[model samples]
Target chain A: MTDLQITVNGDPRRVPGPASLLDLLAHLGLDARSVVVELNREIVRRPRLGDISLAEGDTVELVHFVGGG
Target chain B: MLVDGPFASLRVTRDQPSFTMTRLGPLIFASMSTTLEPTELVDTPLTIGGRHFRSRLMAGTGKYRTNQEMVQAIEASGAEIVTVAVRRVDLDRTKEEGVLHHLSPERHFLLANTAGCYTADEAIRYARLAREAGFNEFVKLEVIGDRETLLPDTAGLLSAARALVKDGFSVLAYTNDDLVTALRLQEAGCAAVMPLASPIGSGLGLLNPYGIRAIKRRLEVPVIVDAGVGTASDACLTMEQGVDGILMNTALAEARDPVTMAWAMRHAVDAGRAAYLAGRMPRREIAVPSSPDRGMLA
Candidate 1:
């Protein structure tokens, strides 16, 4: 289990990643359908979220969908 | 090159008489501002699939380096709606990410796109999966039957759109800039028609603005300029041409500063809409300078 340093929703958190992003989300309790996921600069497609593994020092940004116009 | 229009036969020269401008100025000005007039503005705060969108800017979740940047860029974009393609998170494993953890459904309107599907059936299957995965009614129905052009297979697109709409899915279709096809999709009860400006990720500006304009003229549903947008100017140009909104991906993600580009895009979308509302002066055959009447008399 490699150590990964990343920020989720702007708060820095240290987690074991080298794990797939899907696993990370599972750890964080995120739903791929309702939220938008961006890794590095590109969007991680909902299907690829679990396939895309995390490396050390990778930054993950999760945008939750809120009610708005 | 041959020019076509009312001025095609005008033997335009630097010193020609200002007859054209003098006669057509008022009419020209009126026509220019006609599109810009507030009354000409289409419906705003457009609602689709029980979701309300103010700016009509829908951004794709792709091609960024970091998640924070994506979030920051998205926040900067001022888009209430965003798109995410559905794919299996793990090709190695069978357990799906279940579409719940990527986004908090309560925050933004989620648009599920069938990006990797090639046929109508594949697209339909994916749409159902997305619905089952909690997408429910909202889906960006993309049926790309081709690989090279990344153009929508009109037959496939039409079939899938009709099927999805029949299945009670609110479909926002991604299509080529073909007026007839767009009409067909709109007539099929699509919530929106997202026509490409050029090819996907080509970064080409509106390849055929006339075609897009034609679609806008005929279609009652929101006409969003999707794909092939390279910069903010491209987005603005589409909005100026009277498109209701824009959906872009690569252009923003590839920028030196994705966040800044997103902000620029927001302003561009607004400016273009404002310009369209204010109407643009018609392109005259010759420059209509505000020269003195005495000079004209000479």
Candidate 2:
């Protein structure tokens, strides 16, 4: 299988092929329930995470709520 | 005097010790006396976004030395609502020991804000992300235009507010002291309009009380002074002007003793609300003596 290339939080990364968004989150050690995933500048709802698949050269932005004033 | 009737007899008498009225049978007699007493004003809870809050003071979690300090100050201030900024979660930081730990969800109603966003698109994106993180649709929309002034970009603010409201988010827009802009925000379905007392973190206090008063006069929604409060008196003055609540950060965080300052702010807000409800005396150019002058004897 060909290695998949993607950008996560502005950093380029290579991962195994045929991976789901949930797999990517688990690989990154992020709790699926705690973070929001933005795939290619579009928000992927939590329920749809399993339905979405990672492709070659996809841009992903992971965001969460932090302490703010 | 004593009066006799078919049903009963009534008697009225005044003595040095006391005044008394006596009634017989069905007729009841009551004694009357007069004494001057000060009138008290009633206290009313402030409502925002379908929620009622006893304290009209909202504190910010930024600028504190530590999360513990922030908690102490917020608790001391008696603010039920605390504003928080949303950003990309720092994976390096401990997930359980962040700001959320200090601010218990049961005790504080977290108000997420778009602080660093400079445009409507960015603000909207942050708002959505915040909602995705399980926070309710409550957001403090701040579209900052200039770095020097730290003033809000009204255009971006209006645009973001409209988008958020349409998306079912309860938007609280931080705007300038412009009455027209405040009204426009209200028309855009904002839950509340937060006008800056001055620039953000400047601590200038309410530089233009009349401008704030004007905004409060026209808007049906709650008006909260969002920024630029320097001290406890600043919060009091803003409340005295009839604003619903105040959202402040630097004023308490940067104080010599944030805890003490927080306590003072709580009192200040309450005092101001009381004073405003009690109705202040009218201003006069000529001096009037509080004591009687005509009865003076030489």
- Which candidate comes out best when scored by TM-score? 2
Candidate 1, TM-score vs. the true structure? 0.67
Cα-based TM-score, every candidate: 0.67, 0.84
| RMSD, candidate 2, Å | 11.5
lDDT score, candidate 1, position A48: 86
Would you give me the overall lDDT of model 2? 0.82
* Whole-model Cα lDDT of every candidate shown, in order: 0.73, 0.82
lDDT of 2 at B10: 21
Residue-wise lDDT of candidate 1 within B5-61, one digit each (tens)? 433322222223345343321111222454443211222355565666765678777
**How big is the positional error of residue B17 in model 2, measured in Å on the Cα after superposition?**
34
Q: lDDT per residue, candidate 2, A13-46, as tens digits? A: 8988788898888877777876789999898998
DockQ of each: 0.04, 0.49
Q: Please write out the lDDT profile of model 2 over residues B1-298, one tens digit for every residue.
A: 3334321222332331222111111112223444523222224456777877767899999889877888899999989889887766554553544467567778988888999999999999888887876757789999999999989999999999999999999999999999999999999999999999999999899999999999999999999999999998898899899888899899889998999999999888877776665458999999999999887888
TM-score, structure 2 vs. true = 0.84
